[model samples]
Target: MAGFHVLTGSGSTIAHPKVRRIGVSDILDAMRSGLADFWDRPSHYVFLCLIYPVIGMILLTWASTGNALQLIFPLVAGFALLGPLAAIGLYEISRRRERGEDASWRYAFEVVKSPAIPSILAVGAMLMAIFLVWIFTAQALYAWLYGPTAPDALIGFIYEVLTTRQGWTLLLVGNFVGLLFALVVLSTTSVAFPMLLDRDVGAYAAVATSARVMLTNPLPILLWGLMVAALLVIGTIPLLVGLAVIFPILGHATWHLYRKTVVAPPERKRRR
Candidate 1:
């Protein structure tokens, strides 16, 4: 299979990185690798992974307000749009572990000191902008359909959503819009963050490379996205407590996926 080639600049020079075409097997392999990484020293991830449950709690708190009930689903679903940013540290840990180095939780913070922090933050800002847009769009859709006031109770709201035309319309249209946003995030960040961490490529190149990865292996990338979404939903089912495990596995898996998709640059030959 032909690989997708991305031309990225590293300061004074350019590098052509090849993104290999992957398959379902590769996805499974990556997941297994991720699981192994997580199990290696699961304790190392305990503190590092708490951020997810914290965010989940915050979202739940916000959604508890009667007026904000309409935002419950949107807030939870749209959180996935920022998953790449949340996993930056996990990627660093996986990177270190792969190199047989210290993979302690504290070392994950080392990404803060990386030269690519600017690029990583740039991409994170872009995802945050998209997440905000998704939230506003979902809110507008609900307001247009059901008016500004929420149903008096949670049960009544659920009943109306299942039985009423306006409710059905809101569900369909809102989810469709959310899916579009999700796909955009998946395509743009599938390998962008990890690439930035592993290379000197600027934000533009990293994003371009990620876009190419999606274009070249759309099926595999989409499958990977679905897997991530499914795992997230499972994690959310137990009152967000499951995320401590799910989040780390997914984060590590993403780094492994990046490794499988992108060919590492060749080592430079030094003159004797």
Candidate 2:
């Protein structure tokens, strides 16, 4: 039998016969599958997410001793480094499901056990670099506005300007910059790791393909990106406790999204 090919909505081919284009319903189904798997193996999921608060508290405690703004550095670094590792568990689960195999904690670890570790770590390093740049920019802006030492008289003046028309405008500009940064990295790397795991493709190809997928399905991808952002924001509310569920669900859903997007090359026909 000829292998089936998954294609884009425009009929451009995507994945191999083993992988198919999943619909919105498939996304929901995958989420359900992920939730079921989570409940069945709650300990594994909980353990991974627990790192968030432990790290958050440690940073917060240190920040309390100094300027609160200092905590942002460590917090961003922690999320950048540890977040992907936590999501690896769900990636494994999704991989097993894709192969019609049992989804178990063992399968989750199997996802992390890859010769592609160095490549994934390299991708992680690139992400960290981008994040650090943003952090430094924000820090520089904050320092410029407040300064290392300012008189009490300057406080009123700064407050007036900060709350005025120009302040709002600057705020908007700052937010737009942050949003663009988030979107660029988010869209580029959303399916990056999963793609690497699913295929023998290099990390560069995985990241590039993920960006192409976003460009091809801009609106849907934008909505998906916003959903992830909102969820991550909410997950941070309860001292980061919500991450246990949110991270896993997002990770599994991402795998499904990836399955929906990229196509594998067509297999050559065999002579009869």
Candidate 3:
């Protein structure tokens, strides 16, 4: 039988047991275990993943109507930025179970122990910076194209451009760009965080393996991606309050899904 141990919020030492090969069902069971109490004791898991920007938007909206529009660009950009961090919680839950320990809300913060925190943060920061550049560039281009023109001319031009052949071309191009981005994210982080947590592998390897997994299972992964996107959009209503419930469930479910898709390497026997 696999060894079992306890975990607490104050943090205590427990010996690491021998690693065992786990199946997808094992991961699913763990997810069910983690969320079992969520229904009856919702408060305990409410803060599983703290999305700062959501709160920032609420505050900005409350503060100024003028600044509210500004929040949209940042909110969209920020979600992309924090996607990895949000996935970290799933990694934590899976990692804890792999070690035969109880996973809890406190374990969500244990990702910092993986030595991957720096790389994760660095990658997230770079992505956010790039997105900011894109947002500004898009705004600048729109201003240059339509600014200093008569109001009627500007509106008419926009309508014409949107309905013209050129507009359809641009729309198709935009769709392709979005598809590419989704595929990149799906492949890179599909099983990345949990892999990193389960083993001593670097974040880069985790990303590489995740990408490989996506390449191997394109159809199912694509369906999964579309499902996640749809659910997230639905959860955004009620001012993102729904996320407090939806995010954890999805995070836990993803851990189970990752386990199903990626096989963990067996533990090497020690030389006697």
The candidate that achieves the highest lDDT relative to the unseen native structure = 1
Q: What lDDT does candidate 2 reach at residue 33?
A: 60
TM-score of model 1 relative to the true fold? 0.92
Worst 10 residues of 3 by lDDT: 1-10
The segments of candidate 3 whose C-alpha lies over 4 angstroms from its true place after superposition are 1-41, 50-53, 56-74, 77-81, 97-100, 122-176, 268-272
Model 1 misplacement above 4 A: 1-16, 268-272
User: The CA-based lDDT of model 1 is what?
Assistant: 0.84
lDDT tens per residue, model 1, 3-93? 1112233464344578999999999999999999999889778667978888878986878764687788888898889999999999998
Tens-place lDDT digits, model 2, residues 20-99: 43345655565566666567667866776666667666765665555544334335433643454447667777777666
Error of 3 at 38 (Å): 5.6
Q: Per-model C-alpha lDDT, please?
A: 0.84, 0.61, 0.54
- Cα lDDT for residue 214, model 3? 69
Model 1 residue 86 CA deviation (Å) reads 0.3
Ranking of models by TM-score: 1, 2, 3
Give a tens-digit lDDT track for model 3, residues 33-136: 44553453356457654463366456546434542332243344346434555667655765565556776667667777654454455445545554555445
Worst 10 residues of 1 by lDDT: 1-10
Alpha carbon lDDT of residue 77, candidate 2? 37
Question: What C-alpha root-mean-square deviation, in Å, does candidate 3 show against the real structure?
Answer: 9.1
